[model samples]
Target: MSNNKMSRPADALVEVADEHLDKVLHSMAGETAVAHDDQRTAVHALVAKRARVLVVQATGWGKSAVYWATTSAIRSLGGGPTLVVSPLLSLMRDQVKAAELAGLRSATINSANVGDWDTVMQNMESGDIDVLLVSPERLANPKFAQRIVPIIEHAGLIVIDEAHCISDWGFDFRPDYQRLSHILTASGATPVLATTATANKRVTADVAKQLGDSTLVLRGSLARSSLRLSVVPGLGPLERYAWVDEALGRIDGSGIIYVPTVADTERLSGFLASRGHRVVAYSGRLEAGERERVEDELRANQVKAVIATSALGMGYDKPDLSFCIHVGSPDSPVAYYQQVGRAGRAIERADAILLPAETDEDLWKFFATASIPDVDNIDTVLQTLKESGEPMSVPALEGITGIRRGRLESLLKIVAVEGAVERRDDGWRSTGTPYVYDEQKWAAIRTARAAEAELMRAYASGRGCLMEYLQRALDDSEPGPCGRCSVCTQELPLGGFDVSTESVNAAQVYLRGADVIIEPRKLWPKGVEDGRSGKIVGAGPGRALTYADSPGWRDVARVMSGPDLPLDAEIFDGVVSVLSRWRRQWQRPVAVVPMPSRRHRLMITDLATRIAKIGKLAIIDALEVTGPAPTDDAASLVKVQALVAGLHLKPGVTLPTDGPVLLVDDTYRSGWTMTIAAAILREAGVPAVLPLVVHQLP
Candidate 1:
């Protein structure tokens, strides 16, 4: 792989490719596009020699132009539709609209528009669709395979946008993306073009192997002169919000503020809104229309900024996104680059600011452990499928195996990529592919990711030139300092790491009032005891003061969760304040009941005693634990059974019979403990139970 990896086979073909690019540009934007030599070389490969091409370039470089130009050239010569395997639904929608502008008929088949899938398939079969874009996950879908895979097999050209996802070594590797290999193997002589802006040498090599042995990888200088980078260090979660709130007025135009977790998006966006900045929260959890609406709002500059999780960045087209601010640094520099690249794509200059938090590394490790497949879990899934000799839906599998839904889904995707399992229209079935735990391979990957994480930490600490640091991490051809970043010029944006006292106080107040709701479980885990076989009834919602290491009340949560310690007066006051606000949402509880915990009984009891005193409510011990606590690693049903068997409304107790009671606990994890406690109370004739906890594990 070289910066100049491909050359024109002949002068005439170059001329034709350049002409096609010009046509694509004129049709798409009615403006002339500069003929980057590598772009022409890629188009020539698709049009003339029909070669496999992989392009690794900068963010603002027009990777889409190469494929659109080739599609136009190939279609002019009577070729069939070009299949594009895109990652995100938002990206696919943007691509389809862009294709139409480039004089090509394009339609997407994704999870969101099942209704449009049939019509789009018909168009593809009828040759009316010149560019057919499908998400990588769709290729693995049984229904999509039965319909579109056949048509796509004969596609004139295949383009994989954001091609870094094809590599297991990629910063944002997706297991569903491995299905693209099936297409590559099946599309006999069709020209293939894969493009991405954020792949290192290692990821590039892996993706090229997936493309083909002979694939031409065109590497380019990843120097984005338009992006001026800076870092604001040592900001707590609340302080970060305050800094953004105060800086909104100074920031030039609408941009994005990236947060580490989905929950933070809403919290940050809400705080910014209260400060009189028009903003919206964006996350993958949002519905398709809502995500699109947010994207459109940001693009139109109708809002100050979109406080979002990292999912909002990739392939989102905003020409003049003025600033890219991060509340916490991502685990890797590649991921950080991919995110900040969303800005300055069509502008003279854009600011990329990072506010690094101390909690980011722990979050990275947690998410990493969650995504990696457990050997025993994978074996259980495969062995169960083998014994059943029939397709098993994900829910059925979960019931039988007791793997949680989220982890099970992630595991299946990873195994499916290895051909050890297959998902069909009916359900998932084993493919008889023996599951081997590749210790060496997995260890190597972990090592690589660990190195990348350390590199990011180095970047945050200002070890070297910021631009050169990113370029080197990405293995850019020309890695050099831009001489415009905070480090090089000894300047910092947004007040040089000092936030206003007023703003910080305001943020702390807002955070203290924000309590995350915990929805009660509706259905018992399958395979539980006969007494717990159906829908859960008589359970009410609950609330947690802090979740997942939120800095809102970090010290308070620590003190509350510690063993046998009395609740601090300040902590008790915060709970009272929360109770004051939560009172509106529910009927005032007549009594305070401490949800019995063997380990933290004194701590919880102390807190309950104080709350009982404050609310002028009767203090009662309505529930008590007799049996052992649930095994931490046990299945959901087993955990439920442990709690159910142990938790008995105290042997002889008189309940309030009509009013709700505050069920106080120190921590909430799994929520089964609280659910069973509430069910016991309701069975004993209490009308409702309101759970209050200090910490909620994510």
Candidate 2:
């Protein structure tokens, strides 16, 4: 019995939607799930008006309810299954269960469920599935696109979750989402509804423009009355870790603690765990099962918190997630809003705390240009493909074009969707599609990014009411001092941003004790050193005194990188600490060989001398580079060739043939130096090479 509520009178359809909405709410949220007025209105607009809508509302506003309810009504009216282009795997999982609660059969197609694709497609084709969800990546997949050509043709509704991603102006703009918009542009009157809680006025307008001018834009205030916002600025990395440790003692429920990078996630979560707080480190690095386990742990309140990077960004649903603490500031207010929105959704009051580190701007700067394609990069990629006259994989392109793997793939995807490049069964090839570089458009985006970074600075400074500031930044009509914010009341959660000295000191010990296991390069770079290729073996993981500009030893890091100085007692002790911990995992080394370095020769000599004295091992400073180290580090492939040619065991040097030997370096950058050094050591009859460095440049 299809509700086919579309044929009912306006008042009757609204009432029918209320019934369907409650069932959906009841299934996911339990009974007492009354439909919000806006939820029913949006459903009515989809069913009765057949309108294409964009809903930019705050989190926990039941935006999902509007779509689920409309799907139910449309299906009851003998319409085809609802087609949802979601952005993340977790969201698809959540929505599939949500569809079931609304009494509909649902299935999803994503990378994780490849085995079930045929079953899902069969179910979809047979009209047995009421809702079908696929990620934007799948929408761009050639196979899935071919399969869905007929599916969307009969789809009763098309929903774009996190629709802001369709616009280049979005905080998390993606090329695949833009493809979804193009699909809808041709899907003729299929009642498209795009939803996001993170779009600003420009993004909203851009999304609307993409959906067509007649699309209804329903944007509510960006304010979250349940969120109590505050920023604690000027914290160093150690202090940020300490602050979170201290704050957990006072906070009531399970929540998330966000870090800037995966390293920080490990650092903070380990520190928190040492303090007896139940937390887990989460990032894209985690396997699907592990990530699911962590998510379930948080959902069940089995753990106090999950320390994560932006990899845990969207679509993880936890209504009672009472807090969101950011260890570092986001680059933009929109990003900040999207992350902190995870909190206070179901609870009466949720704390949103920001511990803004001084180093945040550096990371922000790197990411600001990360996804924005550069003319030179695009040209290089295209030219290399043209020169090859054949399709080449991303790795081959990286080796040839000198672009890094991640950035190269991102560029390829953008250009592929734009028709400048095409992906084949084997790899990617140049399509010669003219890239119309809209200089003005790109410049405006860059300027907007800079402006948004400044807005985040303002947000972190408490320039105005926190809620009102975010609302205004997003162009929401909502304005005013949220009387409960730290700026308005001069009150702060977790006792006014003061971290315990006990925790800070513990953080120091923990940071010093943490192991920096540098994974040995798995395979030699192709297109370098006469195209060395094959699995790298007999090279075990290396240890480091510090990784990057470690918070616990930033001062020492600066001196080591800036000045050619001998190791200080403090830094030496930390190195010993790292060695003490790392030794537990590897066989003891019998000798120490300092990596050849011209720039920091004195420091390297001193470090080798100290290791020789302390560990009582032979100091074999036998290997040497032939010429001045490359003045500038080039791409991985180029640098490998330069380093391999120059870096070798000194002519006729005696070598150790048994067990692992310690290879020491003052620093590691691009890793080519250390990698080549280790390979040289192995070839010279050393069974294994264990590298140790003062700092590993990030």
- Clash number for each model: 0, 4
Question: Each model's TM-score, in the order given?
Answer: 0.95, 0.94
Candidate 1: tens digits of C-alpha lDDT, residues 1-698: 11122233556556667788998877766675576889888898777777889999988788888899888877766777788988998788778778888889898888889899888888888889899888877788776677766776678788888988878888888888866565555664788899999999999999888888989989898889899999877777778888899889888999999998888898888888888999999998999999999999998999989999978967888879999999998988999999999999888989999989987788667655556788989989998999999999887788788777788988998888778998898999999988788878888888888888888888898877888889988988778877998889889885564688899888888888887888888888766775676888756888877777666776965675466887777777877887888888898899989988888888888889988987899988888888778765556776887787788887778889768888999888788888888888887888888889877876
**Model 1 stretches with alpha carbons more than 4 Å out:** 1-16, 494-497, 631-634
Residue 273 CA displacement from its true place in model 1, Å: 1.0
Global fold similarity of model 2 (TM-score): 0.94
- Write down the RMSD of all candidates, one decimal each: 3.4, 2.5
Task: Say which candidate scores most in TM-score.
Answer: 1
Overall lDDT per candidate, in order of appearance = 0.83, 0.82
